[model samples]
Target chain A: MTDTILSHDDLTARVSRIFQRAGLSPLQSDAVARTIAAGERDACKSHGIYRIDGCLRTIKAGMVTLDAVPELAPEDGAIVRVAAHGGFSNAAFELGAPELARRAKELGMAALVINDCTHFAALWPEIEALTAHDLAAMAMCPSYSSVAPTGGNEALMGTNPFAFGWPRENTDPYVFDFATSVAARGEIELHRRAGTPLPEGWAVDADGNPTSDPEAALNGAMLPFGGHKGSAIATMIELLAGVMIGDLNSREALDRLGNFTLLPAHGELILAFDPARFSAGREGNAMARAETLFDAITGQGARLPSQRRFAARKRAMAHGITLSAEEIAHLDRLEERGLDAVA
Target chain B: MTDTILSHDDLTARVSRIFQRAGLSPLQSDAVARTIAAGERDACKSHGIYRIDGCLRTIKAGMVTLDAVPELAPEDGAIVRVAAHGGFSNAAFELGAPELARRAKELGMAALVINDCTHFAALWPEIEALTAHDLAAMAMCPSYSSVAPTGGNEALMGTNPFAFGWPRENTDPYVFDFATSVAARGEIELHRRAGTPLPEGWAVDADGNPTSDPEAALNGAMLPFGGHKGSAIATMIELLAGVMIGDLNSREALDRLGNFTLLPAHGELILAFDPARFSAGREGNAMARAETLFDAITGQGARLPSQRRFAARKRAMAHGITLSAEEIAHLDRLEERGLDAVA
Candidate 1:
């Protein structure tokens, strides 16, 4: 099959049309579409159009309550818990971001806990928004289990994506989002599809021995990046987002949403802190001196974290995003199915 | 030099005598001694008796205020800043712990930021104290610059250490403390002392190329573990502890102490959250279900995060801790010189 190019507008409109036809309200459709489009624009292929089929399958499987609204889940002080009520996590965050920033501003720091949600989009958008208010933000969501602990063999932890953003005075915010696993499962799948071998220590075979065969690794499990240290981090994410929030852990989430392979049942946590509240060097302290840290990076000719994505976002918007033939076909199939749902 | 053995009480007593004679108040001497004893008990050589000489040198160089006290800096609601008044961080934390726990209980979350302090002791002591009140705790302290960013050639970041501890119903609070660099500077120093080779990806040569020679790397910089991911985490720590607290950044800390090479002029942040406030899981929810995650680790015979330290601590308390002959000699020398300082 051939590749296809999509203008930014076209990509979002197409995604919106599919969700709308599948019974989501236009508001929800647009919100979801924008998230995907943003991912594509940033060249985060795994999170963009690639996730549509899974989303569609989830919707068809009745895993998401299309009209469900996120409600305040009885929390106060510096921590706020929001019950997503089985809604799309993107919408939950959209509803909660303002409150989180407001509370953190009033009290130096605040955390948002979200549970009973399906989160498939890239998490950067949720946190990156906080930087606009000069607030530092962090968010984590543990999805389907695909990786194992450092020494243990079974796939027991999710890809557990973590994101952090520190606002600056001028340039784009310093933001980074990454999965604790050695590589995202989608990336490994891509290698498998391309008949390529995986890199060393990326994954293990079914018997728990390290293997570079992408398929075997997929049949088995992904390794935590940075060995034990990364494994501990993944565990920490689970404890913070899944266990601490009283949400479905990876195994529980996967089990609860049976047959819904496209949906990532998740529990998430969001934390925000006002940089202004930090009183050091009011003139040129931590908030202002962040530039010095950046200079060190750029000074060393090293690219800043997420610098690549920033560039990709700019280029993709101007030059357009590309979709593989198979991905394009899947989108079309979903569109046809969406029409059936609409009828 | 051959290794020597000393009982835990003896270790603390020896350290205390040296500090007290150096003009430190007996109270201050005991606090510093207790912190060192705790490290020895954990079999953590880097932070134990081996660090005594450095401590003595720092005090002798007039870098530390032996009679200084921790004072609450002007701050409000849910956040408290403590000025260590150029004293030991252990003393600062000891003074702040009660208020930190009290405020976290009252407000669900509270942050304690300490600046103008010397912090060379193990950090676990700081956070582990929070668990006594069933509060989840996290702390970060940025020390001297020795690790470089992923793409940077120079050591622009500190071996920022991060620590977190979660309280459980019946077990020891699950705790883990780690430095963001590929290896702690102390670990590198050990390799240097033993004349052992460094591990691959652990350090870079002066020209920025990867090297495994410990001395060469020590003369150069250490790599951040997990490559770019760990490096970003280090950056975050610097921003949070060094920059946000208005204390010295890693390089600044290294530069300020001038000829005072033994001190780690640390700016640290300690955060506490009452897990009881986590509303998602009142009974078997996230806060309480952390036990399930712990089981997943120990069930696999994989050691829990701080399990080794706990065991080592127990054994050392019963069987006594060990120090090297050189370490014993240094302590003896310091004890003799302490009389001169007092005189």
Candidate 2:
């Protein structure tokens, strides 16, 4: 059968309905639906409609607060905070972003700290939100522990993701969001399912010896990207986003969840910098200067990160987001069954 | 001949005398000397007395301002600005760090922007300055263009150094500073001198084809660490520390200097975060929490980033820094002839 195509709004609405029916508060459902839909719109299928099942499972397990209403903290100096109140991070971020942008403009820079949230979305969406306000932005958070620190034999740090964006004048903003792990745990699971050997340096066995066997890797630990440097960055995220925010670090999150099946409850750190304020009285326009740097990258035939996603987004907005027959049926079932559809 | 040993203070005084004889202002000389001495004390010899001749060479080339006294800009929100007036960045950072710490404590987070400075020192020195104030810190600066973006053939980004530190209660703060490039240009040069092949992925030849020949790699472009992730971060540095701060980017710095011999004139971005303020109203002590994470790392036999450097420092503080006779002779010549000591 031919795939079913839907506009971005249609997908968002459908996803929102699914969550609303699953007993999520309207505030959480709407924000989360936009994030999930954006993932599909950008052809990032792993984070797209695919994540709905995970959300539902978490809700079914009573791991997430179904009626949470994320609240913004009183304006603090250079820090705009949102207490997620045991909900998804999306609504919390949405609640805090405008204030973050405003304070970044007023203070030259400001941080948005989201606490006590079940975080599962990629960071680019949050980064893009701030970049849309014509600001450079950075965000990071720790996932449940899956990756080993470099030189260590066991998993300790999360597959923490770090993301950054710089606003552009007319084109899409420059952006990159990536896991600090050399490869994601999902990728290893995929390899195991396919009965393929894992890549060297991707993992170490249960006893910490280097291994290419997928099964051994699964029983062991994933490695950080770029060896020690990436490990250090992952550790930094745990400190800044987890420990500094007075929330769960990767180990704590994993322990609380008992397994990686559920979305990890953690905190997130996002910083916004108003380019205009930062570049005040400086020689050249910051936005224009950024364009030159982009040109140099593309001129040398190098692709910028997230170009493919942006390209997919452009096409999806123009044509539509297409879902396969199975996916469409899955969405239908989710809409009809709500929490029951998950298990 | 036996190696010469000198206390840290004596070494600093000696280095200061050399810079003074070469006509640097006392303000610039003292700060720069302390940085160099610290490098030696840490056994990070690459940035130690070896850097003196390079400083002299840059001075002889008339690239650095001989007597420029860095001036602090009036307090502006979360940004602490210091105009280095084309002097080396060491004095500028020293002039601005206390204010950066004060602002960070006041605002929870703040940034120090150093502009129009010839930056050659390792960023950890600046990171440590903030950590000394019991604040988590991050610092980045663009060097002259020498490293390529991941997919690009030509060098479009600098071997930009990224450094981070977290404060600890009774020990050295957790610190990690590294170039975003897979390797430093000096490493390739050393390989060339020793007639050794460059490591795979270290660089691409002039035609953008991967090469192992050190000479070809030297003439070509060094790759960024962790491929695209590292490239994106290096680019972020160019944008945030360079364009956003209204200072020379890597390419611009290279173009202005006309060669790589002199230190690149640009800006540095240092962010300071007051953990106490950030974790206020939260459950745990941020500093104590950081120690637990560090303990996990050590418990697993994964060394924290700066342990070796800290160990060297302890030894140097106890027994003084030992310099080979050849290094001692070089210092003597530099002191006697000042800028005339170099070609």
Highest DockQ among the candidates is held by which one?
2
CAPRI verdict (incorrect, acceptable, medium, high) for model 2: high
What TM-score does structure 1 among the candidates reach?
0.93
Candidate 1 lDDT for residue B296: 70
Docking class of 1: medium
Per-residue lDDT of B8-71 in model 2, one digit per residue for the tens?
9999999999999999999899999999999999999999988998898888899889999999
Which residue pairs in model 1 clash with each other?
A243-B286, A286-B243, B182-B225
Tens-digit per-residue lDDT, B135-187, candidate 1: 88888878888888997778878888888888877667888888889897777
The TM-score, computed over Cα atoms with residue i paired to residue i, of candidate 2 is 0.99
Clashes by residue pair, model 2: none
Instruction: List candidate 2 segments past 4 Å from native.
Output: none
Candidate 2's error at B304, in angstroms?
A: 0.1
**Going through the candidates in order, what fraction of the true interface contacts does each contain?**
0.63, 0.87
Residue B337, candidate 1: how far off, in angstroms? Answer: 2.5
